[model samples]
Target: MNECTYKNYDELPLMLNVVQVAAVLGISRAGAYELVHSEDFPTLKIGSRIVVPKDKLREWIDANTAQK
Candidate 1:
């Protein structure tokens, strides 16, 4: 984590929207939604939008990458 990195959830000023998350993970929007509904996925709801924390996404990416 550099200066752009966030140490806490509160420190994160923006979140990766569903589409962005899907894009980062190379998945479709429907796939992202499916993961969102699954117990395996972590998410947050703010009013009407669902946003995934960048750190959580990074963790997910790390886990998956390590599997390979």
Candidate 2:
């Protein structure tokens, strides 16, 4: 997966694929797949295609971000 050029949430697409998710999270494609499969991860399945909503992804990050 190539590095994501997105510097902020505004740069992200409304829906993101596995590769985009990997880049956003700075993780490997395999890792992103694992996360997408996790029960808590936000995802939408449409006839065998899996995608994440950018808004939901941001919410997930906010919810899971560690407090200083």
Among these predicted structures, which one has the highest TM-score? Answer: 2
Per-residue lDDT of model 1, residues 4-64, tens digit only: 2334545544577777666666678888888877776768889988888888876776776
Model 1: how far is 8 from its true place, Å? Answer: 20
Model 2 residue 30 distance off true place after TM-score fit, in angstroms: 0.3
TM-score of each predicted structure versus truth: 0.66, 0.92
User: Scored by CA lDDT, what does every candidate get?
Assistant: 0.70, 0.94
Q: Give the Å error, residue 33, model 1.
A: 0.8
Per-residue lDDT of model 2, residues 1-68, tens digit only: 66888999899999999999999999999999999999999999988989999999999999999999
Q: Which candidate is the best by lDDT?
A: 2
Off by over 4 Å in 1: 1-13, 64-68
